[model samples]
Target: MTRNLFLANRIREVLLNGKWIANTNFKEQIINVNWEKAVQKIGNINSIAMLTFHINYYLDGLLKAFVNGKLEINDRFSFDLQPITSAEDWNNLVKDFISNAEKFANAVLALDNSRLDEIFIDEKYDTYLRNIEGVIEHSYYHLGQVVLIKKMFDLQ
Candidate 1:
């Protein structure tokens, strides 16, 4: 398979579906979680809702960059999740996340293999392939956290 397809598949594996790595994806973990459980704070670690928003924040920004040819996202603002006090709010976030995950994967698949070597946003940020790989790695890192946190909740 092409590099683009491989990258996109990695994105889908972590975010939407494909359990080859983690045995669970973001959709599988967060889709069934209700508002209360999502927002539940365990110690100081991020809530499930916060992690979801954080990942989707990058997905939305990076997906836009893929289309608009510009990268504009701030890590400081990544966790700035608005209050998810209602089931409707939580559901809306999950819905947007799922939509953006698919769109981001499609954007990666559409990328030319040559573009992977091109700088992403700027030289300091490194190549497109690096950023894409970072997304996949970063996602799996947080997905593990989500899984552990959820298990902790189940125990309590």
Candidate 2:
């Protein structure tokens, strides 16, 4: 398989299933969480719902960059999550997150391997490979936070 495909697979594994580094993936972690607990806050920590939005927020931005050849996301407002008022709202967010992740992974897989070395829009930031890999790493980082937040809810 090409390097781009390999990276896409890694992203899929972390977001969906079959993760080698951890037993739980992003989907599994949030699949059974109820709306009440999803919006619960443990001290000043971000709620599960907010973290889900935050994770997908960057994925959406990266996907845009992949399709348009430019990145336009504002880092400061990336975590501005909408309020979750109902189960349907939370479920929809999860659904959108999964859908976007799948689309992002497929988009990456379809790219030419040589493109991975090319600078992503701006020459100052990094290559496409670096940015793509950064998204996966970023997801895993937030996934850890989600897990801990869930554990905290369970304890309480």
Candidate 3:
């Protein structure tokens, strides 16, 4: 029928769905998140703490761009929020991560189907109806890792 219900909207669903699963993936009780333990490396994979912030960072960046009609890329070339090197910082980052996700969903819902495919016509991304879906894919890919990483770390 319409792109909103079919294509673009499906992408937005991925983004929102990632947020839902991620929130559940990192439970303090389930994972036993110790400040030192979280940072420990079991090879070269990113820590769960890093994945948590990274997922949110991308959500914020993409949603912020959608709201402003522009794509913003930080020099670090990462999707996650600021790194969590400490106990307090991790807590705050996670809170902001959840809040940003809620905001991102609202922005997507506010957009019409045409705008989704309106062809950004801007230097950044230079694509149409993909900003939301792109972010959704990014979110899902990382969220899956978050789940796997959680399992990896807990086995210790």
Candidate 4:
């Protein structure tokens, strides 16, 4: 497989299914989480719902960049999650996350390997390969947080 395809698969493995490093993926960790517990905070840490939103926030930004040739996300506002007050709200957010992640994986898979080397919309940011890999790393980072928070909630 081409390098871009490899990266796309890695993104899918981390965000959707087919785990490599971590046995549990983001989808597996969050899909069965109770909405009430998802919104609960452990001490001052971010809730599971907040972390979910934060991870998807970057995915959404990158998706826009890929499609529009510009990155228009505000880093400061990326963590500003809407209150997930009900099961329906949390379910909708998770569905959106899954849909966006699938769209991103497909977009990456469609790119030629050489396109990974091209600058991503702006020269200030890294190439598409770097950004794509960064997203995978970023997702794993927060996925750990979600797992730990879920464990904490379970213990409580």
Candidate 5:
């Protein structure tokens, strides 16, 4: 009913749906994908795993910052996930994907609506927002791409 209540609900909804996409879209595979077959260079570009890891890598950092409030990480854009060379490893990453997202959702739940406008320095963006809305949106957009890539590889 109040403004704070409304923002809290919005953050909650976005987080829940976003976590769902991460878990639901990820694929389990043994014998890691060859960086070659994993991605298609439609002229010049990286692989699907790279893009997916790009998203997940950001998730790891953003979520940690949002929840823990510690904004320091070395691999800013490194999406290299150490080559998922086994089914178990892939599964673990998927589990981590879900777990970390849920952790973020809980962090959102813990935030006060008043703090939404609290500015935390994002060295990359150089701007801030009231809540984690922008970060969540970023993850969701990439999660969609991850879904598309997974389907493409799985179906192939």
Candidate 6:
């Protein structure tokens, strides 16, 4: 497979489907979480809803950069999830997260192989490949948290 295809597959594996690594993708983890459980804090850790919004924030920003040719995401606002006070709000967040994840994967797959080595947005941000890999790694990190947090709820 081409490098772009490979990277895109990895993105889907983490965000959508494919159980090779963590055995649970974001779709599986977040889709069924009800609004109450999603927002319920299990300690000092972020809620499932917050983590879902956090990952989607990056995906949406990166996908926009792919289309608009500019990267404008700020880390400070990554976790700024608006109030998901109702089931509709939580459902919309999940919907957007899934939609953006797919769009981001498609954007990666559409890239030319040579573009992977090019700087992403700026030299300080590093190459496209590095940023993509970072997304995968960062996602898995948070996915683990979601899983552990879910398990904690299960034990309660």
**135 Cα displacement, candidate 3 (Å):** 1.5
Give candidate 2 regions above 4 Å deviation.
Answer: none
TM-score, one value per model: 0.98, 0.96, 0.71, 0.97, 0.62, 0.98
Q: Mind giving the per-residue lDDT tens digits that candidate 4 earns over 55-118?
A: 8899888898888898999889888998888999999989999989899999999888999999
**TM-score of predicted model 6?**
0.98
Candidate 3 vs candidate 5: the lDDT winner is: 3
What candidate 3 gets wrong by more than 4 Å, as runs, is 1-37, 79-85, 121-128
Say which prediction, candidate 3 or candidate 6, comes out ahead on TM-score: 6
Report the alpha-carbon TM-score of model 3 versus the true structure: 0.71
- Model 4: ten consecutive residues of lowest lDDT: 147-156
Q: Model 5, which residues run further than 4 Å from truth?
A: 1-52, 122-131, 154-156
Q: lDDT of each model, Cα atoms only?
A: 0.94, 0.88, 0.61, 0.89, 0.53, 0.94
Error of 5 at 4 (Å): 7.1
- Clash count list over all predictions: 0, 0, 1, 0, 2, 0
Model 3 lDDT per residue over 7-63, tens place: 434444453332344454333321346655555567988876677667666767777
Candidate 6 per-residue lDDT over residues 1-156, each given as its tens digit: 999999999999999997999988989999898999999997799999999999999999999888887999999999999998999999999999999999999999999999999998889999999999999999999999999999999999
Judged by lDDT against the true structure, how good is candidate 4? 0.89
User: For candidate 1, lDDT tens digit of each residue in 41-111?
Assistant: 99999999999999999999998887787878999999999998899999999999999999989999999
Error of 6 at 91 (Å): 0.3
TM-score leaderboard ranking: 6, 1, 4, 2, 3, 5
After TM-score superposition, the amount by which residue 136's alpha carbon in candidate 5 deviates from its true location, in angstroms, is 2.4
Worst 10 residues of 6 by lDDT: 60-69
Q: Is candidate 1 or candidate 2 better by lDDT?
A: 1
lDDT of 2 by residue, 1-156 (tens): 789889989999889884687777999898889998999988999999999998889889888888887788888988898888999999999999999989988998998999999998998878989988988888889899999998787788
